[model samples]
Target: MLLELAGIDKQVGADTWLYPLNLTLQESAVTILLGATRAGKTSLMRIMAGLDTPTTGRVLVDGQDVTGVPVRRRNIAMVYQQFINYPSMTVADNIASPLRLSGQRDVLPRVREIARTLHIEEFLDRLPAELSGGQQQRVALARALAKDAPLMLLDEPLVNLDYKLREDLREELGDMFSQGRSTVVYATTEPAEALLLGGYTAVLDRGELLQYGPTIDVFQRPNSMRVARAFSDPPMNFIEARADGAALHCQGMGPVPLSGSNLPSGAVTLGLRAADLSLQHQGGDCLISGQVQLAEISGSATYVHAQTPVGNLIAQVPGVSHHQLGDAITLHFSSRQAYVFGPDESLLRAPQMEARHGSY
Candidate 1:
């Protein structure tokens, strides 16, 4: 492991903000930390970078305990969400500031090389105030890269850029990490960002580590509804449910067939992602009736929002869709696509669900 945290905890003003958390970031791979605002993602990154002292537990890098080390001595580079630059200095000076502070004499050539890599070589003589927001961000990244640190901590580095610029920067950053083989701990509130930079993903809720594992595994098999909902764009659709003697009963989905016999009876939550829901010509097994409330078409696909007895649900259909607003549609799902959660909001991996459904 390149970076590791065990039993980590943090608090502020007598209130326990973050609970015990553990994470292992592999060398040469990117670990994206994902959560909503105020989930303590930044705090965790700060602790790992030695910027903030942990209230308890330990922080280890390459099997070395550096928990109490100061930020300057940790040898980690951080790219913050905001653009922190010397407004009065040129881009070249900003990138070389760290090397000069460390008393390194031969730094200009290295700074130039990093600038070229980040595609900012031409703007080296321009002051930060004269550059665009994206350019300034690239300069910050170049400075971090020039440091040649073993670990890189990026806190929402692409949040401030426009859509196209953010995409381009994401690709560039991915390439940089691949070339350097540097361990990275990235913090982002976007699910797409986490999936784009595929690696270990840790979901945080109220400072607690909810689930951490391979990105695909966590997205496909979320531990709970909360974790599952976190990965969706508009979020997952939830509906009340009950387990019949041998069927799972939902208000709109009807009684879905169960493959096992030991299902707990009572109220449950049914979760279905927008991508998992489909429109069908007729009602069949696991079919739900709903009226289209809105339709959004974007290039090759269309998103249909429907109003059903259970609640509002969104479905993504490939290519152009024929459905229109106020049209009654039949929504279908394979037993495999349905995720059932207990009343306590914990995931219920019923044997019947797994045994019957293979795609979910």
Candidate 2:
């Protein structure tokens, strides 16, 4: 299925819900809608699934316009953030609902197969109300998968699940969606989820399509500050500075040189990822000394929040370590790894800059 959103824009009364935008979804491909809260991801997906019509523009499926088509007329199945299941129905019956509606007599095997994939087979006989939040969500997913529609739309389906279950399901679903001739459009607020899915991504902000490209490419080479913020976990570190020839004159800090930069000398914003900035007492042009404000340890990484001369910044370090609050620390990173954004938040690096030096 070739899905094309041409000049699509949505409005509610006098308010704008989504700005005019165009996008093409390849056949059997997964396109992730990455954004922050209320960024219009849901509205965009609903438009694609034919649940809502764009106030202006066309929806083309395989080159045929389906703009005015209703949800019931489209061959798409959707799973939402909130659990949507027949509360009175058992998990088995819930998974089998779509199959039974289509007159499939052998529904038991299909129901059980999907249940096992989602690791909810043991609770197949329990009603939705009897299962935990995660289990009910699995049942909902199973039902949607049972439909096997050509177009699958998932709107942050795992957002309501517990952290562990979300991790487990994300991996499982990533594997499940990799195959099959289904064109998938998944909407989510988490950047990690989009990276885990490993597909093309469309970054959205304030109803605008900020950037669209391969997931890794967009993640590493965010087109602007908006896209960078939307695709970062623990958020991105920013430094207010002015371009000085091939370097930046950071406010309250010294000038830092960025070789091979093509930016014009002017006010700019320097963006660096928390993980990109190394936590160490090292000397470098990109070094910033600060005192620890908070250190959050997650088994695999430690997120240290510190106040530096530039501003409050966070650094994600490998492994857990004991760093007393108010302990002095220095954050260092290579100048090439930083992003140079113009006063308007538009990226100012040469086209080859990201390809040559950008890292996650």
Best-fitting candidate, scored by lDDT: 2
Off by over 4 Å in 2: 281-285, 350-360
Best by TM-score: 2
Report how far off residue 291 is in candidate 1 (Å): 2.4
Clashing residue pairs for model 1: none
Q: What is the TM-score of each candidate against the true structure?
A: 0.85, 0.92
Tens-place lDDT per residue, model 1, 1-360, is 378898889988788778988878767788888889988899899899888888999998888899999997877789998978888989999999988987899888999988886678999999998898888998988888777677888999888777776776677777776664678888999887777777778988778889988776777777887787776765778888897655688765567766555468888877887767888643444777889999888656688999998889888777898766799988887665667788988877522232111122
Residue 305 miss distance in model 2 (angstroms): 1.4
**Model 2: colliding residue pairs:** none
**Model 2: ten consecutive residues of lowest lDDT:** 350-359
Which residues of candidate 1, in runs, are more than 4 Å off? 96-119, 244-246, 258-262, 280-285, 296-302, 318-325, 350-360
